[model samples]
Structure formats: C-alpha cells, structure tokens
Target: MRSLYKIVHTTCQTGWGEQEQRIYNESVWMENKGHQVVIITPMGTPLFTRAKEHGFRVHGVSFKRFSSLKDYGQLKQIFKDEQPHILNTHSKADSNIALPAAKKTGVPCRILSRHISDPVRNTWNNRKIYKQLTHFIFTTSDYTTQHLQQVFKLKDMEIFSMPSGIIPPQDLAPKESARKALARDLCLDATTRFIGFAGTISKDREVDTILKALKLIQSQIPHHIAILGEGTPDCLAELKTLAKDLGIGEKVHFIGAKEDVWPYYRAFDCKVLAPGNKNKIPLEGVPLALLEAMYSSCPVIGSKTCGITDIIVDKKTGLLFDPQKPKNLADMILDTIANEAATLERVHQARELVRKKYTIDAMGRNIIRIYRLHQVKIARQYLV
Candidate 1:
C-alpha cells in the first residue's frame, strides 16, 4: 500500500496568476490521490476562497514582511496542530514566515519552491533560509536551479528543477470552429489570420517588439494580432499608442483577461512570447502560456532568452528570434506563415513533448517520489 501523507502549502501572493493556479491544481491532485492537503494564504484572496470552496482545509494569515510576528506565531501553532509530512513555501514573504515555523515544529520535509528565474541576492538571511531552514528546493526551470546554486553554493542534490504542469483541456474545439467563434465574438472577419500574445501586458514582456514586428509584416501577410490578458492602465495606453504610431492600430486587438483561454489558443495561427533581455536577471521560467499554446497545437515563436529556450528549441519545437531586433521577429513570423507543413510538424512535436513531460500527472508523480525518498531517509535515521 502507498503511504498517505498530509501536506501544507503556503503562499503570500493574492492574485490568480499561473503560480497560484499551480498551487491549487497540485493540491487538488494530491487530495484526489488520497493525501490530505491544506492551504495557508491571506484571507479573501482568490486562492484562499477557491481552496475553501473546494472543501480543503484553509488558514489565512496576513503574511506581512516587516511585522510578521503574529503571522509566524499562527503558522507555528498550525504546524504543531497539523504535523504535516511536508510543508512547501511558494513565495519569498511566505517562506520567510513559514519555513522557520515548519522547522520549529519539526515538519519532516520542508520545501522552498522557486517559481521565477530572477536572481536571488546572496544575503546572509537568504542563505540561512535556503540552506538551513529548508530541507530541499524546487525550481521551475534549470535556469533558476543553476542561479540558486551559484548564488548560495548549494549542491545539485539539494535542489531540483520542475516546471509547473498544465492540465490539458478535455474537450478542445476544432481549429476552424474555434477560429469562427472567436472571430464572431471579437468582430473580426472569419478569414482573418491571427497571431496571439497571452500573459501579462507589461513592458518587461516586450509587447512593443511584437507590435513593431506586426507592422513590418502586415503588408506582406495581412494578419491580425490578439493581445490577451490585462495590464496596468498606463501600460495598456502606451501599447495602444505605440500600435497607432506604427500604423497597425486597427490590426491589433486587446482582449483583456479571459477565464477560458483554450478557445483563444485553438483559434490562434501562431502564439508568441517576447520578453525583453534588458533586465539584469532573466524574467521567464518555462512560461505556462507557451506550454498551453503548444499543447493546443499552435505554432509558437519566442525570443531566445532564459527559460523560453528551455521549451522552444529553435526550429525543432518552434521558432526563436532576437528580442532586440523586430525585423528578426518579422522574419520568423513570415517563415511560420510561408512554411505550413514544417510549422505543423513542429507543432506536433511540441504537443508530444508537453504531453510526455509537462502534464500534471508527471509533475505530481515526481513530487511524490521526492517525498517518499525523504520519508525513507527519515526512517533510516530513526533506526540508526
């Protein structure tokens, strides 16, 4: 018989982004697999409400940075009461509060999940948190794993890289059907070709590069670009002005965030991610948007940087371009359009890769394996 364990997951983020979604999904999967799961987040956040609605035990704490004594005390008491087999912390603020609490309570396995590729400062407090309080580290990409290792001089066995898995849609609409439905809703012509950009609409995402590339190729291909997801009002206005300045205003459609993005993925002729390389640290970690698009069989194009390269693989899985040069992105877009058969082949390969490696089941099993290994080590130590 398999061993059943209780797991506690904590996060400080309140928004319903990919990171929060991953935590919710992983918790649900574990619960369904006969393990008990609990969530600790700030009150009234989407994650807190959703987990509560789904019938999981949940505790809310303020998760403040400067004045976190109350939060730490609450977490410690909860850990003592529950005595979870594993305690996983998702964000920095929560980790700062929960890791020490879990350690004090003697939680058998403590994990710190690093979800972004941004650099970690080599501070004394960070070292203690990562090296002493936490038992093992989980990173979303090899980029982050190597980054943490280099910064804190952590050994390979101390950290593992695993991208959050996506749940494939059960009933995906046919491509033509999806395109026609999206066209009707967006008031576009049924025959209009679409290029898609999903995820946050921030400057760091480099959406202007996509707009400039669209301007360069509009006359040649006669395509439209759909900008999905929402951003700050100022960011939205800046992108709109840039599109108008480039004379591609009418061709660019900004459809804010959608609850169901699968239909949009199915409707897209190609999906793109164009994060800027100007930041001192890399900003991506195997983007979930690209994974969803690839699973939907949409040909993808991304800048050759950071975790984007982990999935794109240039011409094999999808195309890659330089974020610094809009013309390079334009050429990649044109190449995808002109070579339909090759693009389809790449899409097939990409979808297979996501299925084999990036599915929720795969991630769940890997995590459980880690937990079981730790359990065995603890048992051996007790025997000795």
Candidate 2:
C-alpha cells in the first residue's frame, strides 16, 4: 500500500472550468486513495462550494493582493494548520497569493499547475517569481512546457506534463436511448445525424467557423448540430443570427451550458472542435472536452492547430481538419458520416487510449509520484 500524504490545492477563480474540474477530480481521487486533500478558494465561489459539498476540507480566503500582508497571514495560518506535504496552486491569481504563503510556512513542495498555453513573459520579475516554485505541471506537453523552460530557466525545479483526466461515464444509457432523450428534450429529428460541440461559443471556439462549415455542407448533407455551452447573450444571439443567415437555423440547436454533458455525448454521431482564433501569441491547448467526447465513444473532428494533433493522429484516433477552410471542415464531417466503419474504428482506438492514459486514477498516481520525488529532492538538499 502507498503511504498517504496531505495535499492542498488552491484556485482563485469564481467560475468552474477545466482547471477547477481537474483539481476536483484529482482531489477526490487522492482522498479516496487515503491521502488527505484540502481545497483553498475564495468564499462562495463555485469551486469552494463544490469542493465542500464533495467532502473536501475547504479554506475560503478572499485575496485582494498577492503582496497583502492580511491575505498572506490568513493563508499562512491555513498552511500551518494543515501542514500539507504538497501545496499545489492553479491560475495566476492563486499562485501569486499561495506561493508567498507556502514560502512563509516552509511548505515542503510547491507545485504550479499551468493549464494554459499562454506565453510566460521573460522579465526579471517573472523569473524571480518562477524560481521560487519547485515544480510545474503543464496541461500541454509541447507549447506551454517548452515556452516555460525557455523563459523561466529554473535549474532546480522539475517540470511535468499531465493532461486533465476524464471521469468515466457511469450508468450511461444506450446510444439509441440517449439520442431519443436528446430528441425529446431538444426536439431534434430522430432521423437526422447529429454533430455535437460542447465548449464556449466564443471567438476562440471558432463557433462561427463551424456554423459556416455546416452551411456549406447543408445542401450536400443534412445534419443536426447540438451546441452545449453558453456565452454572453449578445454572442449567443450573433451565432443564432449567423446560423439563420446561412439557412441552418432550423438544423442548429443551442442547448446552453449543461451541468452533465456526458449523456448527450451518446447523442452525437460525430463531434467537431473548430480551431481557435489566432492571437499575436496564440493560446491553445488540448481541450478536456475533446477527451471526454472520446471517452464517451464519440469520434472527434478537431482542428490541426494546437495540441490537438498530440492526441489525434489524423484518421487514427480522430480526424483533423484545417480550420481556416470551411469547405475542408465540411468534407471531414461528410466523410465521417459516409465512412461509418472507419469512424467507429477510430472511436474505439480513442476510447482505449483515453482509458489507458487519461483517467483520474492515472493522473493522481502520476502526480503522487512527482510529489514523492520532490520530497526526496528536498530532503537530499537539506542533507547536503
């Protein structure tokens, strides 16, 4: 049996996205494996409330500033009380506050979970801040990890790549049953093949591009699309209007944000993840949603940009499309429907890959290994 250790995780975000979910999943798994896990968050945030409800020891601290003595005092008190073996902080806000508190309390291991592919600024201040950390766990193996290593140049700290894991779908109804439920709820046509998308309908999501692709293919192939996320009212209205203008308003269904999107995965014949809009310094990573869809046995069509290619080896695990071209996107979708056998084969491969590499248990075990290694390193340093 593995020895248990206390782990403290902090995320200072109000909304619950992939980062929050990753923390929750890993924390639950760690607790179940006999490790003590506590979550620190701002009071009444979704992450704090959910962590509490799920039986985690949660400390709520509203941090005004990273340098605030009051905030530091509160966090230092929590660290002293918990004495966690590992202090893992996610996001810029949480890390800013948590790092100082951990340092003050002499926390054994400091781990930063960098979930985005945003570039790390190569400034003296940024380097100083990063040098204080002992480890980095990046969501992407390629961009974020490489960028940080080049910029931070931390000689002592270890870097790890661990993608967010999927909670295996429990008690998922049969595909036909799920599709029927979706049809009943969303008033979708039973006969129509459904293409699914389950991310924010923002510019980065390229929801507009998907709508345009669907328009190009509508005359060639008729399909229903179920969008299962939310954005601002104006953004949502714009997408709806765009669909209408493309003569696909009737075929497209915006189901808004869903608390449970797993069941609806069964309703999709094929899922599309359009490429993100490029920025000066593009921020992109493998979306956890794509992995979840794969886990649900849904064959995915993802854009070639970003870390998507890391998992999707075009026509192997999933199909990749050029997001810049709407016609290419249309062809990929059409080909997926026409080639059912190939699609199913790809889905099976994806499901197996996810099961092997991307489960909460796998992630927790890998992380625990890193924590142990860090502990050993710290001990060796003290001995020397």
Each candidate: what lDDT?
0.91, 0.81
The clash tally of candidate 1 reads: 0
lDDT (tens digit, per residue) of candidate 1 on 1-384: 238999999999999988899999999999999999999999999999999999999999889876599998999999999889899999999999899989888998999999988778988999899999988999988889998999888987789988989899898889999988888887988888799999999999999999999998888997899999989999999999999999999999999999889999999989999997646677878898999999999999999887888888889999999888999999999999899999999999999999998889989999998898887778889899
Per-residue lDDT of model 2, residues 1-384, tens digit only = 237889999887778888888888888888888889999888998889889998899998876564467777889999999988888888787787788789889887788888888778987656655776545554454666667877877442467677887888667768888887888887656666688999877877788888898888888776788999978898899999999999889988999888888888888988899866466444466678888899899889998777777678898999988777888888899988899899999999999998888878777778878877776776788899
How far residue 127's Cα lies from its native spot in candidate 2, in Å, is 1.0
**Which prediction has the highest TM-score against the true structure?**
1
How much is 334 displaced in model 2, in angstroms?
A: 1.1
Worst 10 residues of 1 by lDDT: 276-285
Clashing pairs in 1: none
What's the CA error at residue 37 for candidate 2, in Å?
1.3
Error of 1 at 175 (Å): 0.8
Which residue pairs overlap in candidate 2's backbone?
none
